[model samples]
Target: MTAGLRALRRRILTPALSSTSLEVRGFRKKNPTAQELLETVGRSFLEGYGRIVEAPDSQAAEPRLEAIPREFRGFAYEGAAMACSIMDALPGSGGRRLSGLLAGRGGAHTYMAYVGIGWAMARLPRMLHPDTEDTDPLLRWLILDGYGFHQAYFHTDRYVRGQHRERKLPWPEDQASYAHRAVDQGIGRALWFVGGTDVDAVLALVDAFPPARRGDLFSGVGLAATYAGGAGADELLRLREGVGAYRPQLLQGSAFAAEAREHAGLTVPHTHLATEVLCGMKPHEAAGVCREQRPGASDRVDMPAYETWRQGIAGALVSEGRS
Candidate 1:
């Protein structure tokens, strides 16, 4: 089902994508806004596929993007994450290529780009670190999250990993410590892609989160289930039974996926179909929620922020558990 959806998405997105060649550095527009600058990163990612082959890596200086307001700086990573997705689809060592391109950015941009790497790696889930699988839930997510960051620079900084290794984990001893908020958000959704839905294995790792961290864990589970189109009705139900108390988190993840699909420019059918299949929600209910917060045409989707703020009721239920 996912394969079919991918095919259809490419078809729908192609026409619009084809008309515009990707423009990375040279923004002819004078005084681009923060949102425009961020949006460029995603469009450049699309453009990179089209132009990178023909256009030599432009050593010519890119026009300076204005300072990203502190609150919205994380958006840089979100944009870079979109680029990483494009790079991952390409054959061979794209992470190295990505690192080089991002080298010139601000410190936050560079760090957040690794979180993007985590997001991309979730799609393919190369578990370079063995401990991630057997470790406690918090450690497991961190390792999984770290692996994505690690892979992004694997080709370029393979040996330099030790230089600032401790900085990556603020509390190296604490499994739950993210060291970086971007990584904390990046991990849970990513776990779904990286950790497939082996009910016992998945739940075991999830159970390790304790009640405090389960919301994030549940989001990952929901994302994996929705995209795991093969999860089937029975398996999804089985999953619900095992971790049903966190259904709100699961639906939030589903909505996140749904919003992303729409942002990818796929029609509602493409996005909501997977939700309908994996979420086991009433088709209309799922579709309604999907469209409820769907981005208006050409708007940027701050999915991380969206996922962080879930349906109020879901948030309330999960919050109640917190107290």
Candidate 2:
């Protein structure tokens, strides 16, 4: 990459540039590959994630995740939103970039790539219709997600031909497969987060699938709800109690992950405190521990640990993307 492009990549990775600073990368049809974008996402929020949260409206593309509660940042929902926010900053060529990425073999490998696109699509309605306030945000989110999924799978941007209502899901599901059915299920999951905590739609979507396929679908639902801060400690506990025994740690871990990321972004000491709390330490004790260990700005933070915490939770959620 040219030095200019490298600098641009760094800038894009961190979140929420002031609206004034946007377009400085010089928008072109420069649709960087999925590999490039995947790399770029790493830095987007590393430096300024907390600042973005501190004053989200100052950014060019307002991150939808900022509107949600902070408890779910560890959830893939925030990942998706971050991905979407990144894509929104680019031009139409982003569709091509996303399509190329999706062409690869499916599995845990491509899960994050798909998430970036899903996040972008989720924000499209608001981006496209800035003044319109739809009564049903969940339904709106589903439409955007489905449309983007169709475009990615079918490799076309012109949805107007039929708006992808007639896409196929002929691929049979198995333990290793992520058929077109997974896309539909994921869209259903995004709905629960963008909408209220109402799970009626989520349960219905889960019922539509075999018990085997429900895990992948519900993973999205749980992650989205938690990551988007739609669920609190009480609600998370209730959700865990109600769901299959396979998912409690993940839901809780996602919340903790969000907390960790937030604290890390705000100040490194908070990161330690958050980790201690997640490891079953009392909040008061964790806070005291972190207070004593807090380091100066001259010292580098253990950002790797923070990233590891995020990846650990998100990776598990994506791995559940079975057929």
Judged by TM-score, which candidate is best? 1
- Local accuracy of candidate 2 as per-residue lDDT tens digits, 181-243: 345444434334222344443454345545554454554555444333333444445455455
lDDT of 1 at 283: 38
User: Candidate 1 — which residues are off by over 4 angstroms?
Assistant: 1-185, 267-274, 277-308, 311-323
| Residue 273 error, candidate 1, Å | 5.9
In angstroms, the error of model 2 at 302 is: 34
Instruction: Candidate 2: list runs displaced more than 4 Å.
Output: 1-114, 119-176, 179-185, 199-201, 245-323
Cα misplacement distance, residue 229 of candidate 2 (Å): 1.5
